[model samples]
Target chain A: MNAQFRRRIASAALIIGFFVAWELLCLAFNVKDIVLPRPSQIIVTLIERIPAIWPHAVQTLYTTLVGFALGIAFGVLIGVVIGSSRLAYDVAYPLLVGFSSIPKVAVVPIFVLWFGAGTVPAVLTAMILCIFPIVVNVATGLATTEPELEDVMRALKASKLDILLNVGLPRTMPYFFASLKVAVTQAFVGTVIAETVASNRGIGNLMMIASSSFDVPLVFAGLLILAALGVALYVIFSFIEMRVTGWARRKDEFALG
Target chain B: MLAPPSAPPHAETYVALERVTHTYGRDDRQVKALDETNLKIDKGDFIALVGPSGCGKSTILKLVTGLLTASSGYVFVAGREVGAEPVRVGIAFQNPTLLPWLTLRDNVMLPLKIVPPFRQEYHAKRRTEFRDRVDALLDQVGLGGFGSKYPWQLSGGMMQRASLCRALVHEPQLLMLDEPFGALDQFTREELWAIMQELWIAHRPTVLLVTHDLKEAAYLANRICVMQARPGRIIDDTIVLFPRPRTIAISFDPRFVALTQRLRELIVVASPPKDSNP
Candidate 1:
């Protein structure tokens, strides 16, 4: 078998082995399902309750995606502004740092007070969380463009806008993609935080309700679904990143065996 | 020393720097990079500015290309004053500054997409025509089939060749080369010099090449300007009398050797002393 296939097999074996060990450990101890549910019990609960849980899962996915999309759009806009001009960067950077430093969880209540316990708070939080890294990275990418390349453009009598469009934006793709990966994960966190405290629907709310009834396996199932969703989104972004900015990656970075 | 002939601002003077001076920074931090530097390059002349580091060879180029305005005096190109508008010049630097993301063909076509006249027609279904020009230039530089490849995939020598094509693809009137072969190894550098000579001969652009290598200056340029550092100014201008289609064999010629040696002596005398080892 090829090394990549072998590596994939090894990973699958490791995950399956861990679950088998968890099952046996719980059985030997005769542990109560309340204290900690076995992997098998959690999986069974997930399967049994999936019909009732489907809508909540969809709700969580929708909120996270909406928030993430808004976050990316807002982040890229701020990034371009801060990145292109010295004055904007200087004026906006300190305020952005202070705002990003404020715990996103703390702002959910204020969002609830303004927009009232719903999807808006989640999106705003996700968007705010995403803006910092994207702005910092995009600005850095534009600022670091080679002066020699800029001179090349200037020699051709290209305008400032033309220079930015031709050289500045394309060069920022690698940095922008890097920030996207970080921001996507943060988007999920923001959505879940808002859902648990304020929303009547979604996986976070389902988990909170399950925990109150001491349906521990159901809570674990909710956690499992969120993890899967996060992984799915992350993987999709990674694929797109490769397609867009593969030129920036060194071929030897992933050595073939 | 024979007095250099004064340029009378003739119609054929494609580029002229009349007592131009350039200073970097401002006030106490100010440092003079060029001082009353006067140069005249004819419409089709190929000239090399040879000097030690910090001798303002590059500064002169920046001024001519209108990337930097002179601190004093007139800088003229194509009989018009430079500055207040960008000059249409093609530039290639030592690093082969190709956009990593673009295919070699796309990079070569970049000037047409941005420069006036060509850019006006760039989006109007003339893309195929521009692509043909890019391909033709690529073929000339021996990168015929490699146009679709990204610059990162190419070897250093190949990338530099592509850089040359990008600089010349627009058929610019002035070509500014700032140590375009400085980063290459000896064999690669010589090979590029021959290619450079052919390109210049094909379509003569009033060329200003800044180089540290005296032999490279002697091989490529019809006239060589030797400059002195610390408020830099040209110390000597020697005209090379070599015939066209000069080959590598001609570098061994006694006259060629004497010319390089003379330029070397002028630089060595003017350059500052190195830090002594105790």
Candidate 2:
């Protein structure tokens, strides 16, 4: 326990050292505050602008969560359908690839035109950006179930649904959780980009306003908050991943270490 | 009025293969896996298939299980022609293939949940009974108290034992094994042979085992069918008159050695002759 504590302390010190060096470099270079604010200035600005930034932060969070959820739902549904049938995969995969190739941020104007400027456009942008990972991961997972196991199921005279539920779903869960982590990150990025282009609300909009006024510290504060939010969401999903895939972890521990 | 009295079920063949041919790939480049293969299996017979590699031994197991349809001929199981219809067949593979997400008990209980009659009644009435049967089978395979563990928690031998228990849990009339113990060490493989013999003695499921081990073939089977390489056809159908309740110690018996040597010679002859110089 003491050793673990010391290790954590060392990690924290390393992070603190990094921040101190960054601040010192900015000061030594006599950089204009608008160009690159020090860490201390960013923190102070964060505290001062809390009331102005809070609502926008909340809006960004809401849009990201809703879009991320929708993305996962639709992606999993379509992915499973395509993965189950060769004909569906052949017909839909080319179209999916074509659509995914379009820069998601470029569609923000179209989405704003379609849904009007509010949470809807931001959410749609996030959904479009995040859905691909879930679909591809789920399709690959479903397609790659062990043939030997399938044969065993077949010999037992199991129905198609039975094989899917009992074998396919359980095996694909690890892949699903892994892809979800990537998708959630993309969801946050989509929300920010969407808000930057067209919104009176959200952290991205706040950053835009700060940039126009040359309030560099305030812009940095907004970026810091977004980073924190992204990190927090990622950590939460990672915890869920650990819980869902506890069996795999245990097996790995036994096999490797 | 009923038709004339039918033949007794015991006298009727339980599984039959007639002029079965399986060809892989398309025309011109097609390779025959099985050619005009014919065999009959009685209700409670224990049969072993032995051959050189690429001899389609595993294909025969697949054909009987209806996992693959024959290219030309008819196959029957329990007096019914093979099609999409469900039959009572249990199978174990070279790899254990247990569902990693499920506990050992749940893995074993998979068939009971899926196969009908049992499936319809599974959630009701027979829940505890089913659990008890799984536990009993686990104990029979020396896996008692390990059912709560996951497949990855078990060793290779233990996992294979669990797989056998899983295959037998539904008590199907036919059991097919494709080199089930081939992946284990020699010691573990021999141990499982005894366990399998005891299990077969207690529950006489008609079994078809595909193996490359001559000693394994001689020790466990009542009859061993040897097939030629590639366009495989049965080259030798030898019966082992070994007594029941045979143990691994039988490997030391002179007769066992003679039987194994005879099988090895047949396999060598059946294989494309290798030009080896002393």
Worst 10 residues of 2 chain B by lDDT: B1-10
Candidate number achieving the greatest DockQ relative to the actual structure: 1
Which tens-of-lDDT digit does each residue in B17-104 have in candidate 1?
A: 9999999999999889999989988987889999878889999999999889889999988888985444568999999999988888
Off-target runs (Cα >4 Å) in candidate 2 are A1-11, A86-91, A251-257, B1-11, B125-127, B273-278
In model 2, the clashing pairs are none
Worst 10-residue lDDT window for candidate 1 chain B reads B1-10
Off by over 4 Å in 1: A250-257, B1-11, B84-86, B124-127, B274-278
lDDT of the candidates, in the order given: 0.87, 0.87
Q: Can you give the DockQ of every candidate in the order shown?
A: 0.65, 0.63
| Lowest lDDT block of 10, candidate 1 chain A | A248-257
Candidate 1 overall lDDT versus native: 0.87
